[model samples]
Target: MNHVAPPGWPEQVRPPDAPEWERTAVGWLLDQCPPEYRGHTVLRRHPVALARLTAWHVEACQAGARRGLAEARTALRDALPMDAVEATIAALLTEQARLEGVRRAAGLVEVALRGRRFPARLPGLGSRHE
Candidate 1:
């Protein structure tokens, strides 16, 4: 059977075949760090920090989605509380807005290290390797 993504879901879900490290935020961060700085203690530790932040952000997003879904369900059963529904929608919108920023920040360290500007659009993020 074919799987269908829900409306507003991200176009790409997690890749089933990706390696464990490639599937994680810390690993992605570490892979993005500049080759020269990879040996530096601070740089080596950066991924761990980023991973923690990503985890928290993801949790917030998940919570927001859940709240929004519940609110929508409640609306179907009774008079919608517009305030609560709006708040939940706002939270989900905030999550979508911040995702790009997180992606950019994850690559900023490496871009700065390489003396290259971080593009408004992340280009060549995955192809970079020491």
Candidate 2:
């Protein structure tokens, strides 16, 4: 997946530049999110939710990288009743997975079409000098 850093995001996740307002955090997180989730209005309306979600995302990313994806997924799920941001991220991830599946299917179709148009040569199926 393409990862474009949000404008005004601190160089790192912690210290020095962490935002005080949940609204700010929400904006920052949205910037980092996929195009589909970037415009979600629920995040804008709920500051507390946004804050919790952002915190969870930061923790999950750090932990996932250090430990493993399964651990990260479990950790987030364990934080149940997730905030808007967390729920949004989860939804976005699911959407991303769905999109990836569609992309793969399209690629397979393309390969099949190409193969039909230009069949590959077999090494010994129809040898001329057998």
Candidate 3:
């Protein structure tokens, strides 16, 4: 059968033959992102928001100085008080945000290395080989 998205929704959002559980799981996953990335998590009420936000943050501090901070973020989710998954989707929208910076930086380094001007190609490799 052809896919019919939710009421008044755009075609792009049409589900991809997904089962209800799959959709629920995906929704749960998306909720974990920061406010901007996914949107507000606890939209129903203030208490729900605070509790969910707290559950999503072990220390409740702003993004940590370095990658180590993700551990805390992770801990918050992983160590839920009662295994509940509720959160906002504002994780990666602003210029200051970086959920995967290290990996991205590593990719940039790889690109730089690939573009480097080597004086001599190695013996078994390349344009400099005689």
Q: Could you estimate the TM-score for every candidate?
A: 0.31, 0.31, 0.18
RMSD of 1: 14.1
| Model 2 Cα lDDT, one tens digit per residue, 79-115 | 6555744765666667555444433423322232233
lDDT pick, better of 1 and 3:
1
1-130 in candidate 1: lDDT tens per residue?
Answer: 1222222222222221233322343445544333454456653456445444444554565565666656664653355577766776676677656655555444443333233422222344432211
Encode model 3's per-residue lDDT on 1-130: one tens digit a residue: 3322222221222232334422332343334434563455443223233324433442222244343334435656666642332232233232225334322322322232234222343444422211
- Between candidates 2 and 3, which one is better according to TM-score? 2
Identify the leading candidate in terms of lDDT: 1
TM-score of candidate 1 relative to the true fold? 0.31
How does candidate 2 score on lDDT?
0.42
Give residue 14's lDDT in candidate 3 (0 to 100).
21
- Which window of ten consecutive residues has the lowest lDDT sum in model 2? 1-10
Per model, state how many residue pairs clash.
0, 0, 10
Alpha-carbon deviation at 26 in model 3, angstroms: 1.9
